[model samples]
Structures are given as C-alpha cells and as structure tokens.
Target: MYRIELDRDVCISSGKCVAESPETFRFDSDEIVELVPGAPRLPDEEIFDLARDCPSGAIRVFEGDEEIDVH
Candidate 1:
C-alpha cells in the first residue's frame, strides 16, 4: 500500500501528476494540486513516475511513513 502527499506551496500546477494518474490527483478550487480523497491504489512503477514527472518536486510518495521518489 502507498500514500500520497502534495505540497501546495511548492506545486507549479504543471498537471504532470494528474496527467499521469488522473484518478489519483486533481486541481482544487484554488488551482493548486491535491490528492484525490480515497484515490485508487496505483502500481509501484506508476507511483515512481508520478513523483519523477513532477517538475516542482512537490509530490511526496510514501510507503507507510517512508517517503519515496522525491528527489
């Protein structure tokens, strides 16, 4: 299982995360990024790609409490 965290302050609104995993992410009314509540689980590879594709490096992927793919 995995958990996703997004840093709205660091987000650039690039839409890369949403484009890669539409069911997992969406834009809020403020135009910032937010993880979809109760978003469907995604494969590990897809999780890595979501973080990798984030130009602002605002997306935080976690396995339990350990963050992944946030470089």
Candidate 2:
C-alpha cells in the first residue's frame, strides 16, 4: 500500500495534482486539494506522478518501509 500526505500550509491551492490523478485527489469547496480516505488502491507510479506534478510541492508519497519526497 502507498500513503499520500499533503502539506496544506505549503499547498498553493494548485490543481496540478488533481489533474494528474483525479481518482486520488479532488478540490474541496475552497479549491484546496483533498485526498480521499480509504479509496481504491493506487500504483506507485501514479502516486509519484501526482506528487511530482504538484506545483506547490505539498504532496508526499510513501510506501511500506520506504519514503519518497516528491517535493
């Protein structure tokens, strides 16, 4: 399983991540990216792409016993 973490403070409210992975990310009423909880599983590449594409560098992707800093 992969874990995604978002730094709201650092997020610039950009939708780049959402564009990259709509299934895993969405914009709230305030247009801030929100990650759904307990959704279907995602491959590591999708998570990596979402994190890499985030303009605000607020996304962090992690795997079991491993961590990748997309920022």
Best by TM-score: 1
Which residue pairs overlap in candidate 1's backbone?
none
Write one digit per residue (lDDT tens) for candidate 1, span 2-66.
76788899999988888878898899998888888888888877777788788998888888888
Tens-digit lDDT track of model 2 for 10-37: 8898778777667778888887788876
| Model 2: lowest-lDDT 10 consecutive positions | 62-71
Which candidate leads in lDDT? 1
For model 2, how big is the CA root-mean-square deviation?
2.1
TM-score of 2: 0.77
| Model 2 score (lDDT) | 0.78
